[model samples]
Structures are given as structure tokens and as C-alpha cells.
Target: MHRIAILLSTLCCAVTLMAQPALPPVFAQTDAARMRADAITRFYLAPVRVMQSHGATRPEVLTRITNGQTELGRNGMCLLSNAEGDTASITLDYGRELHGGLRLTLGSSSRPEPSLVRIRFGESVQECMSDTRNTKPCVGYSTDDHAKRDIVVEIPRDGQMEIGNTGFRFVRIDLLRTGVTVAIKEAAAIFRYRDLPYVGSFSCSDSRLDSIWLTGAYTVQLCMQEFLWDGIKRDRLVWIGDMHPEVATINAVFGYSDVVPSSLDFACSEFPLPRWLNNIPAYSLWYLIIQHDWWMHHADRALLERHRDYITQLVDQIDLTVDSVGRFRANVFLDWPSSADKAGVRIGVQALTVWSMDAAAKLCRILGDSAREDKCRAVARRISSHIATPKKLRQAAALMVIAGCMDAGDMAERYMHGIDGFSTFYGYYMLEALAMAGRYDDAFDAISRYWGGMLDLGATTFWEDYDPAWGSNANRIDEIGDPARKNVHGDFGAYCYPGFRGSLCHGWASGPTAWLSRHVLGFEVVQPGCRTLRIRPHLGHLDWAEGSYPTPYGAVKVRHERTAGGHIKTTILAKPRGVKVITDR
Candidate 1:
């Protein structure tokens, strides 16, 4: 009886171990790769804020302060007195939104005694002044606790000190000591980002387009920090879905930066199998697509070779999720407004799966692995065969075309015509599909209507999502109405995201910069590092447009003007020597 009981117990234990899911293979980073990543991190130092502003709570005190000029000889200074109350606050603006640490030069008074002060940082003026209860991620420092404070230093001293990093365009300094005053001789923000040189420019007859391009470029720059954060304000992590569009835009503007491969490596290394990156399955697929993009533009063979085994593991993991019916069984995330439950079975996810498989095949081919390339292509073909009908959404249909699952002409007419339920994030893929289908006229119109609509609403930088009908009201309630709030700048998210939760300056929404520069200005990379350039200028309804695209070698400048006979007069202003410039009219 004892021997029989032992046998049953051992069988039960074995069954329990088999039931547990398998973990992904661990990717070991070589010492050389680790050193390379560390070197890249060290080379990309953050920039300093060149501008500043000052404001006070009291109207009279605010008016009394002068706008400090950006003079060469003197640093900007603002004084705070305790006449109003025991605590007085001064607001500082960095001119543009940024994510970084703060440094302030505090001037000492005649009194030798030290005084305590509290400083709060915010990404917006309203956020800085708002009560702590209302803010989600509140950032403030108190001198009372030296160890717990953001910056570890003595207060009320005539010296400069550094505050910890945060996402902010505004800073509020509160004087805590009664009858004590302090003069802020100088204040500046150390802007953190991957310091890549700007190599792209776009200008046109419409000054609004020019402003929009630059604003979008700046938004991209703000998000290109340590690891391509989704945005500066909130959820500042490397989300693969958001990084897809960001990587494309970075290719056109920043050229070949190490941040791209570093971000990809971080995602794959951090998230193992059976658990998707960010717990979203579609995001993992997007990461695969981004790897293909990195190879095509930057052509970093060493990086791709280093991550080959890890990439194969990811491809196999995704393949396992597909059943006989060719549907993705894991969590499907389309966009912000999409429903996860419904998106799981939707055609969008299937299309993305096929796209990812195709991308994997391309990467395998680049790596000279013919056997793996053939296997990937067979799987992609099998999945593409199952996509008989495309989803009604523009993003799904667009991805179908881009992945070569369907004829571009057939799907373009159905998806590209209407703007209903169109979002800026998905709009990026839709615009690319329209341009790829030889529909430059339609692509140009979509750009003007969708992106130009944002400009019409007085947008200095692109928004996370925009609808033309929303019209001057930032508080417009979305579908499934939650409790309405007056003067709220963002749509509600049912406690998940409260009032004014939408990011005003999002990174992925800045697709117009890439669209205008690549499609409209007709600058494309035929080979990685732009060894071969393709300039096919499409001046649709514009009098003229000119831009310069950065390459691994140098800059390639091009200009196009519409002639009276409806012909495009193209001119190549500058190009690197030995580089082939192919102009297609």
C-alpha cells in the first residue's frame, strides 16, 4: 500500500509540472554588446533649456516682475518676497515641453540662518498649480526630509544644486520660511534625449504646414529620450505599438541612431515568451516589424546578427499562437480606442500577424538564412490565404495592403475614402498605404484634411487623437459618456484616465513630418543608410516644396515646383558623392 501511494504521488507531481507554461529562452548579452550599449548611452547627453519665464500667484506681484531678456552677459533672475504670505511661489517655463532634471542657482540673503523651501514640477502650467489630490503623478520636493527629497542638498545657500529628472515644461518654487526671501539667479532644465543631429527639413507655400512639420519634429525629439518613451507626461515607457510609427519617423529625421537598436534589444531582453511585451500580443508583433524596419534603414548587420536567436524565438512564439484557422489567439490590441476583446478576433490582428511573419521572412533573408527565410514565407503565405475579407477599419485594410495580403488597388478605394472613426495613430498606416498604392493625390488630400485639420484647431504640436468635428472644445465627451466635467481638456477613461488625461503632445501622432518629407517631398531610402536615394516629388496643390534628408554619408537636398503646364520641375540642390539619385516623374 505504501509503494502504490508513492507511485500515485510522483505521477501527480509530474502532471503539475507539465501543466505550467514554458518560459522563453534567456538572451545572454555578450560583454562587447553590453559595452556598446553603455557607450551609446554615455554619448547621448541631454541638452539644456535655453529659455525661461517667471510668474507669481498675486496679480500685482506678477505684473511687477519683468520678462527677463535673453542677454549674452547676464543670467535670468526672479525674486520672491514673503509680503503676500509665509509661502510665495514662482513659475518657470522652459519654452517647450521636455523631460529632464532641473538645476537652480539660489542667491543667499544677508541672514546666515538656513530656511526651508518646497519645489513642485509639472508638465503644464495648470498641472503645476493644481492641487496634489487632482494630479496622477505628482512631483514635489520638501526640504524637511533631506533623505526623502528629490535633490539631496542644503537649502537657502548661495550655490547651485541639481533636482531629479521628471517630465515638465513648468516649475513652481514655494518659499516655506516666514519673513525669508530668496533670489533665483538662474534656472534651467537639462533636457534628456538621444542627441542625434537633425538632418531633415520641410518647407512649403503653406506656412502652417511648415510650422506643423517643425512642431511634429519637436514632439518626436521630446520622446526620443533614453529608450523612446511613448510620451513625456505619462506612460513614459517603451511601448512597441507606439514605437512602430516613432521608429519610421526617426529614420527620416534622426537617421541612424544607436537608440533604435538599443530600444529593440531592451524590449526583447526584458519581456520573455508566454508574456507579451507590455502584456499586449500585438505589441510583440509590432516589435518584429520594427526590427525589419531597422535593417532596411540603418542596415546594422551586427545588431541583427546578435539578436538572431532571440528574434527566431519570438517568431516561433507568435507562430504557436496561431491555430489551424490562422487567427491570433493571444491578446489583440489595435489602438487606444479599440476594444481588446473584440480586437482579439478581428481581422486587424490577423492582418498584423501576417505582416509580422512577412517582416520576419525579410529579416531572415537579410541574415542569409535561406532555410528560415523559406519557412517564414510559407507561414506568411498560409496566413495570407486565410484573410479572405479585410476589416472595415482603415488600419486593418491598410496593413493588408502593406503586407501584400490583398491587391492595393482593390482595398485602397474602400478604406481610404472616408475619415469616420479615423485616429491619428492609425492614420499613420493609412497614409502610408494610400501613398504606396500610387494614389499621391488621395494621400495629399488625407494629409491636408487629417493633419491640416489639427492645424485649423490652432494646434502648435500634434495631438494624441483628433476629430475635425470636435471643434474648439477640448472637453468634448467621447462615446459611452462618463460623468461630464466642465472645461476638461481630455476625454474621460472611466477612472483609468480622468479629466485632461490625453497627452496634448504625443510622439506617435507626429507622422506628418515623416509623411510630408518622405511622400510629398519624395525622399526615400532605396538601400540601408540611403546608399541609393529615390526622389519622386509629388507637389499636389502646393506651389512649391523643398526639403533635405539626412543620410549615413551626408544630406540630400531636393526642391520641387509646379509648372504652368501641370508638370513638376524637380531640382537636386545637394547630394553626397558616389550616391545614386533616382528621380521618378
Candidate 2:
């Protein structure tokens, strides 16, 4: 017995000595970090606001605030003062040296609003006069692809000025420095549809209208008419609403609709989305982490662990109440504050839940916590099993995948109602999930149906809403429009074609099309920050489509060539995948 005990002790000591030392936390690679930053910026595209008809009817001053003269400096603010009559001075200040200069755009609406304007600046400053001829009027049905060529101004020293003959009705100054102020000495021009339904309402205490306010209202109608139309652009399975200007502003200022409770000093009433219309914080938190991981192409285990307890506890409490079908049985009918439960028990909720668990499991594996990994895996399997097989559920879940893969469980055909489908609200999601799941045929059929329908409608830019076939209540707007409120698409002309006509050339919906142009056309972006570049491309329809875009890294161009096989062979200008490639499929 003594000999056996000694041997056991020796073995234990040897095993302990053989263990490897802990590895230090490796910060994300520079390229990865750059990619992540790019994704983050794109994911949260900053909305630019400007005066619409400043020079048309009213006399106004166009101010260019450089990074050096603005109150917060860094071109953070620009002040446009309407002299209240014949003359006005637009003051531009960048305040201090610590602040850097940023680009600002100034322009008239698409319809020419002529005004003789002059540029002036401090003695040390250069390029005080903005070249109105070069400023591309904020025109076009779709501003998504438009360049920011309006008033390109850099904050120089203490003073910069741009004066115009007409009282300006609209002026858009980019946030270049902190406390960027625009004071109009003249009376601002009033909008014609200021009191229409869904026109304008909603903003932070600062009362800045989101760039998408007009677009949202215009698209809301279409979304209601046919869900997938918007889905094609928004990606139903993902949280695209967070990208809207008003939505972003509200969430940033008031706290994300779901998790506002966690943050103190946030008055719930201060937010626009009532508690009843918002999502649960846990959902947002989980989705945020998963999104970060998916787009950034990495798992931050330490970060995950830091929030593990809170996430785990909240999920645990949630699970206790949810039934086998994934419904909150106890509060099934009882709605939470600011929560939207329109698609209850559908794949939308399940997809996020499953994804979060899957992500957690990945983190656990990376952290060398086999036990926790097992736990997360088991939960993931359970959720997947419950969510993936039903006709409606499967189609919905497939959309959640975003890879456009399809499988046996897919029942998109079963849910099709000619014009609308059970999954209409999630167009892009349907394509992505079907692709990821390898349900290529179904995904193709659905895309064809949607594309054909849009073509039939003479759609230059995709609408915000539509049925499975782009038919039905095809109007692209919500019922609410009032100039007093900061509503999307109700009052502004951002989504209008050439900034004059109301139409569906929307920026948000175009993003998905860009993805398809890359994915289906097989075009890949290879540059470092230019992850969206394209070399090889194919378009199913249209004479010839070619366009170049400026990305953080560089420029990308997309071109397509038809082939007999009908499948596009793509060539990437650069390699998008850096150290590793992630295949969710």
C-alpha cells in the first residue's frame, strides 16, 4: 500500500509538470483589426444631415468649419447664420490644435437652387471658398452609392466663411469636431410636407433628424406591402434596424432599445421606441457579441468570459420560462416593454439564440474549458434541433444562415402564397440561409421570383417592402408623416431620385444587392480595408453593370460576363481572407 501511494504521488507530480504554460492574450491581428474597424464603420454607417433648399427661396450663409476653428474643433461643427435678410455670415471654427480637420459636404437639392456664394477664411487658412461647381448636388433616388461631394471643407485656423446671395434653406455640415454649431441668422425654410403622416418625428435631445428619416417612411409602406422586398436589402435574420440613422441615434443616446434598463440615468420615456416596441437587452447583447465575432472573424474568449456570468444568468432565467417550442410559455401573450413580438417563435428569435450559444461554445473551446464547451454545445444542439426542421421554422431558420444554402427541411415552397410567403419579411435572410444550408435550388427559385417581380415593377432601386414576388401593397412608406417629428422618409429627400422625385432608390436595400453582386457573381474584394473590391462578376439580367466604389482600404470595381452554365465565375481583385477563412456553412 505504501509503495502504491508513492507511485501515485510521483505520477501526479509528473503530470502536473508536463502541463503547458498559459498562452498570453493575443490581440487581434492588425489586418483583422482593420477589417473589424471597417465592418464596424460599414455596419454603423454614419448618417449625414444637410439643409435641403437653403439657397432656393431663403437667403442663407454656408459656413465651413475647419478642425481648428469649430467649438469642439476637428471640424466637429459648422454654423450657418442667415443674416435674417440680405446678408449673412456663416462662421467656421476649429477651436484648437488637438482637434483635427474633417471633410464637410455642402450642396443644393437636385433641382438647381442658384445662389452666388463666396468663401473667406483667416489669413493663415487656405482654400476658404468652396467650389460649388464641384459639389455634386445631393441628387438621386439612392444616396447609398452617392459620393459625399457637397461642401468639402477642412477646418483651418480660427475663422472661415462662405457667404451666399440667397437665404439658404438647407445646409448639411458633417460632424468634424466636437460642439459643431450651425447658427442661421436668417429664417430657415419650412418644408412643404412638414405635417404629413410619417413625415418626420423622432430624434435625440439634440433634435437632429436622421438622414434616413425620409427613406424609412417611404420604405415602411413597401415593407408592410411585401416583407421580402425590404428583406432583400435588410437581411431579415440579422439586426439591420440598428443601422438606421434615427434608430442608431436613439439607441446610442437612449441606450439600445432592449438593454436600456441596465444603464443608469437613462429615462425610459426619453427614448422614441416605446418599451413595447423594442427588443430585450439580452437579445441585443447576445446578437452584438455574435455579430462582432462573425464579422470580425474571431472569438474574444476573455471578453466573452468577462460578460459570461451576466449572459449566463440572464439566459438561464430565460430558459426556465421558455417551453420546448422555444416560446416563453408563461409570458407568451404578455408583451415586454418596447418589445416587438410580431414574429414570435419564428426563426428570427431562435437564430440569434442558437448563434449566441454556438459563439459561446467556440469561446469555451478556445479558452480550454472543455466542460463549459460541452455545456454550450449541448445547448446549441438542443436549440438547433428545436428550431431547424419545421416547414415555416426551417424556411425561417434557413434565412437566418445568410449563406443561401438550402436543405431537405426547407419548405419555402410550402409557405409561398403566390405574391407573399410566410417568410416575406426576410428576403436577404432567406437567400443567405438557403445558401448556407446548401438548399441552392430553393434559394435560386426564390431569388429569381423576387428579382423578376422587381424587374416587372420598373424598379431602379429596390423598394423597402414587397411580397415574395414583389407584388401586393407595394407602396414604400409608413402611414405616419409629420414635419414636426424626426421620422424617416416623411420629410427629407435623401432616398429620392436626383433629390427631387420620391422613389425607392434606397441606400440600405442596396447593401444586400452589393453582397449578391459579390457572392452570386463570384466577385471577391481582396484589398486590406477594401474587402468589398471585385474583379470577376456576373449579372443574371441587365445590359452591362459596372461601378467602382471607394472603401476605407481602396477602390473596388465590379463587372459581369454571362456564361453557358449560368453560374458566374468570380475573380477577386484582392484576397479578402487574411490568416484564416470562416465558413459558417
Candidate 3:
């Protein structure tokens, strides 16, 4: 009788608990709004313009391409008719960068013979028009790595075929062979992206800066795939160091995103201790900094706790590389620009190591690992004694400033001058170091001038690497029909990205978006979890600026304007609940 009563009691309690609503986990963890494969929504969009057409390429096909949709009583198909040994092709400009593939709905063909089709997806008109194959005549650094932009396939007499799930702004479809006419009922670029609201925003007196800001944000937006990728066009992998600026921008814009933490955790899992991230020394160190940067904004202890074992071991492993005097024992590699400069590369790595240690110390303190915390701080102190003079490399100079091995104002004057040695990857740090010196105006101009240079060339998104000199004689990627002009997409880049293999839509280059939000609006997360914020508007040359910053609680709206007397005015348009806003006028 006693056993029966106890069993009934347990059953009753279970039933009661089951009746309640679903509750979050006990630990304070950010909701990993996991996007499953089914969550991938496709937006089929038609091309805006027929960039080029050859050999019976009819313009009326654009309307009939969408099944059963015809402007007139014409046949419901894009007649891709070609002659023997000759090809008929049409290049369509979608007008922007897309992350998905092309979907071609096919109708009945004129002949029983299967028509051969060649599809080329390009980030530019130059890329789409050029042939990219090992045996092809047109060759250089143009490769289909991470994405198969160039492809050849056969179209059935009655069915459709789609090719590519890559980044592109243009699509060129060619109908190959004779005695066969292929009718493409529809040709649509399948645009896939996470359906997330952009809680963060920025606007200013300068329209150019505003365009750059939004463009940068959109660049990172497309990169938020299964993982936070370095680029959508190429190098579509979770590069830890490359994800820093991306994470910062995500925090400032999206407020909180599952992709950030999940990507970090994924990188930690993909490469354990004794293995550097992306097989680069500094990238492993970047993982440490990413943790702190995310924790400060999201404050998800549960997510941080998930990487407890990995984080501790990684930091400990990094500590072993440092000697008593602060030099790194491991191979020092920072970025492509300074890769040749062995001395500069070593200094950059040392500074990055120190910067990582500082970040690790904080992370360990949060995880209650006091022993590792002390060890990180001790190593940081030892490295601080060593000074880094990054003369020509802006990447190294910026790292040195953040690592406290160099002064910001001095570093700016010595290394960074008029877009000299400006890299899209480390550009944010240079901007941050400038902000550290309170030279917000110069930073503002740097964004306008350097990033503006890309905008001037009709770039919808930023590139993996850029040189202002490239634009001196380069034709805009969108300004098609000038074969004699210099092709920016095909002509520049070095290291991993050479010539046409260069990624035109790189997430690492989206630093200006985060820089504008952090420095111009001056929205600093002074405390972890965004419990407090410090907004000190540095309008610089701008007469006024307004923006919204995302917080865990809610989005904070702010506007700043300069008075005629030169006195700056700041007004808090809106504040989230439980978030304290402190203004530094």
C-alpha cells in the first residue's frame, strides 16, 4: 500500500509539470533560434535588365519566362535557339548580390534532341562573360572554389534545370548546339536569406556614408549562412579572425543572433587544442576575442559555458607558445598584406597574442577559472613589454594599438595615410584605434574616402581586398559593354585571392558598418549584457546623425545634431527597458 501511494504521487507531480507551458533552460542562455534546412526560404526574382544578347536572343522572353505570364499573346517561353557549332547566349543582370542559385522552368522544346546549356553566375558582368575552366581559353586566377559559378548541363525537351547556389549579381545562360531550340519558361534567381528583422540602423548627414553603412550591413547579412562566412562568393568558411568585425556588426545591427554564438562554437569544435583555427596562428587567438566581444553584448553565460572545456584548453595552449620575454614560439601569421613582411607579421602576431590573452583573462574570470585568468594576465604583462613598430602594414599597426604596444595617434600618422596600406579586413581596428585617439573626424573621412572609393566604382557590396589605385583606370563592374576598359573584378588581388578569384562580396570588408555605428553614434556597451550603454556622439564633419542600436532588452534610438554655435546636442529618442543610457556630451 505504501509503494502504490508513492508511485501515484510521482505520477501526479509529472502530470502537473507537463500541464505547464514550456520554459527556458535553467542556465541563462540566449535562444539559439536555429534555422533548419526547411527554414531556407527562396525568393524567386526576375532580372531587371537584359545586359547583353547574341544570335536570336529575344527581349520579349523576359515576361514569358514566368510560366503562363506573357505581356502579349506570344509563346510562353524564352526561345534559346542556337546554330550548329555556334552558341546563342543572353546575360541577365539581377542588379544585386544574391546568395542562392538560379531556377529555370522549362517548357516544350522545338526539337526532340536535348539542348546543351551552359550557365555562368558572376558577381560582375566581366566575371559572367568570361569562361572559367581548367581547359578553357580564358584563364587566370578565376576559380569556382566554394562555389561553382561556371557550369555546363543538358536541358530536357520538357523539363527545367537549375544550377548554382552561390553569390552573384549576374547570370549568363547559353544555349549550345544546333537543330535544337530550348524554351526556358522562366529564369529566376533563387534568393535565400534568413527572415530576420534588422533591429539596428544608422543614418547621417552624408548620403555616401549612409549607403556604405547599409551596404556593409547587407554584405554581412548574406554571409550569415549555415555559419558566419568570410565571403559568399569565395572563402565561404567560418574564418575566426575574419568573423570579429562581422560579429561586431551583427551585435550592433541584429542586436542578438544565434549565428554568432553557433559559429564560434562550431569553429571551436571543428578545431580543438593543438590545432589553430583555419590553420593560422592569429585566427586561433581571434576565437578568444570573439567570445568576449559576444559575451559583452549578448551575455549568454550558457552559450559561453558550452565552450568551457575548449576555451580553457585553447587559452592554455596559446600560453605555451609565449616565452618569458613575450615572443611567440609558434609560426606568426596575421594577414595577407603583411605576410611577406616577416618582421611585421611577427609583431602583429605578438600583439594579437597579447590582445587574445587580455580577452581570455576576462572570459576565464567569467567562467570562474581564476587560475587560468591569472595565467592569461601574467602572459599579457610579459608581452606588453615588447613594442611593435608596424611601419607599412596598417593591419599590424592597428593590432599594435589595440594590444597597447603602440599609440593610436602616432600609429595613424606613421602607418595609415590617405588609404595607404588600407585593408578591408583590419580597417575596423584602424577605425577603432582612431576613435581611441578621439580622431573621429579622420576616421569618418577614412570611411568616406576609402570605402567611398568602392561605392564610386558601383560596388553593391565590399570586396575581400581593395586598392584605391585599382579604381584609377578600372571600369565599374556594372558599367558593362566596354571590353577595352579595365575590369576591377578581374584585374586585382593577391595571395589567396588572385585576379578574378578575388571575392567581390566579402563579409570581412563589412567593417565600416560596425565602425559607423560604434564610433559615429558612439553607442558603446559599457557593461556586459548591455545593461548599460555610453552614447557620445562625435558628429565630426556631419551636421547631424541618427541611429538605432540593438540591446538584449530592446532597441535604443538616438539622434545627434550640431548647433550653430558648434555645441553638440544629443537626444535619446527611445530607450529599452532595464537599459541605462549615459550620455557623454
Most TM-score-accurate candidate: 3
For candidate 3, write residues 1-585 as lDDT tens digits: 223224334644554465344445762435445423443445677888888877644654663335423232125556777667878888888868888998877667776767778899888888888767543223243678878888888877666566798999898888877766766667888887655566788888888888888888878888988778999888889999899889888898787888888888788778776798878878989888989988999898988889888889988887888888888998888778778989888888888888999999999999999999999998888888865586577777788888888888888777766667778988888888888777887888889888889888878888888888888777787867466767887777788776678888888888989988888898998899999999987888999999899999999999999998998899999997899999977
Which ranges of candidate 2 are over 4 A from the true structure?
A: 1-348, 384-409, 416-425, 434-514, 521-568, 576-585
- The residue-level lDDT of candidate 2 at 493 comes to 32
| Per-residue lDDT of model 2, residues 1-585, tens digit only | 223224334644554475454334585445454532110000001112222332222222323222222232323222333333433333332211000112233332111322233332210011121222223424322121222223434433333343221111122333233222232222222111111112112211111111122223323222221111122122222223322212222211122122212121122222222221124533332433342332222133344455454445434544454456654333221112112433533444555555556656655555566776666556555556665433444334443453222242443444432324322224544455544444544554555466335434433334343333223433212211233443222222332122312223332333233234334433342422233333443343432333333333223333443447665433233322332112111
Model 2 alpha-carbon miss at residue 258, Å: 21
The C-alpha lDDT values of all candidates are 0.65, 0.32, 0.81
Which one is best on lDDT? 3
Cα-based lDDT at residue 216, candidate 1 = 74
Ranking by lDDT: 3, 1, 2
Q: Residues 20-112, candidate 1: write the lDDT tens digits.
A: 443345645443465333221111112122122332222222222232223222133355566535566665555455666666655554356
TM-score of each model, paired residue for residue: 0.77, 0.40, 0.90
Model 1 segments more than 4 A misplaced: 1-77, 83-87, 109-118, 134-154, 340-345, 388-391, 406-413, 417-420, 437-497
Clashes in model 1: which pairs?
A: none
